[model samples]
Target: MRIDGRARALIAADDRGLLYGDGLFETLRVRAGVCPLWDRHVARLRVGCRRLRLPPPAAGALERDRDALIAGAADAVLRITWTRGSGMRGYAPPLAATPRCVLALAPAPAIPVHWYARGIRVRFCDVRLARQPRLAGIKHLNRLEQVLARAEWRDAAIAEGLMLDTGGHVIGATAANVFAVIDDMLVTPRLDQAGVAGVGRAVLLDAFPKTRVRALRRTDLERASEVLLVSAVRGALPVRRLDARRLPVGPWAR
Candidate 1:
């Protein structure tokens, strides 16, 4: 782990990321020592920094740290986290706070190959995401809601759980983005109200010209011909069952 461009494993106890969840994090897939989706991660990080009023580190600095951590790794998960530097007590941030950047590399877990071929089953989470447009679409460090939602299930057969916004609109799953195919067109929930706008979702939207971004209801998902769960690390997995409904693993998923 590299903290603020230095090689270290310890961070200050008063660090804003620890004291208060004032930070942002990006998780990218490192393949053969190279991150294919680096640009997208950086782009999303910048958006988070801008929204959170945190200064972003130099692009070159981040790349250097990432390269150093991923040295010679074949396949790994690289995480870059930034927090408002240590400060005094209370929620009001210091005026001239320096940002802290931490980067780490971990071995990528082996995913079930059959999940991609045969599809995976998912469940609807009881936890509803609170609508916060200011924090929406960014991979921020404040993920207690997700933590709670993930704990709602203990079934190993369920690959992911779908979540809805406080207003009852389908947002996404615990970690990945959700998409449904209807009438030969792709539809994904809009992040303007809630949910993280993921890099894989952006890739899919660009790849499929018929993609549409808007509010999605549970009925919309039930009526769709196919459902897909996408993320930078997972790539794409077809959803064969959502709740008690069985969805088709269509050709588009392949």
Candidate 2:
């Protein structure tokens, strides 16, 4: 089903997000008619707007739109998109942009509880993420890299792909952040250079005071006692395999 609201049918074909992928988006999970991470999602959305030099939308209006879209859904994946709005045929942004926002809600995928219990198998993707410090932590619309990495395998056994940055650092998975356990410390890759700073990663770090955020290399990943993938939509997912190497379940695998 399509998104419903007053703004739903107002998306223009010439919108920058559709035309040039010049926008930011957030995917949130709705449970029991409430979004647990709504504040964090709004914080990230504001940060993304600041980074992209786009105007922020009104929070109350956004909430109203979101509520309207997911009114009856018990569980849903809500995608909120914001663009620089319409403009003339040019590469430069408009002088006074009003900005366009769209909130769409749909049923979430049926993820088996066993997937988390048994852990997931992942492979090292050939796709290398470019180091764009300016756009490193923001969830922008440019995702060709992820698309290519996901296309590397069609096997259902391989749940996801771990991606490395151009500097040979383990940035993150195709759609989630990577966290490893080393000497009883939770170490995650620093997003100053690349990778999306996921909401789930932030939640874990906030919940666990001992969690350490640092730059991780390829060798660091190979030596990790435990590796897990995390995102806002999907919580923590343990990685069982990377390429031909098998990772044993450790204390943090849960």
Among these predictions, the greatest lDDT belongs to 1
Q: Which residue pairs in candidate 2 have backbone atoms (N, alpha carbon, C) closer than 3 angstroms, thus clashing?
A: none
Cα-based TM-score, every candidate: 0.98, 0.95
92-173 in candidate 1: lDDT tens per residue? 9989989999998889978999999989999999999999999999999989889999999899999999999999999999
The lDDT of each candidate is 0.92, 0.86
Kindly provide the TM-score of model 2 when superposed on the true structure, using C-alpha atoms.
Answer: 0.95
* lDDT by residue (tens digit), candidate 2, 180-249: 9877778999999888999999999898878888888888888888899998888888887877778876
> For candidate 1, what is the lDDT?
0.92
Candidate 2: deviation at residue 173, Å? 0.7
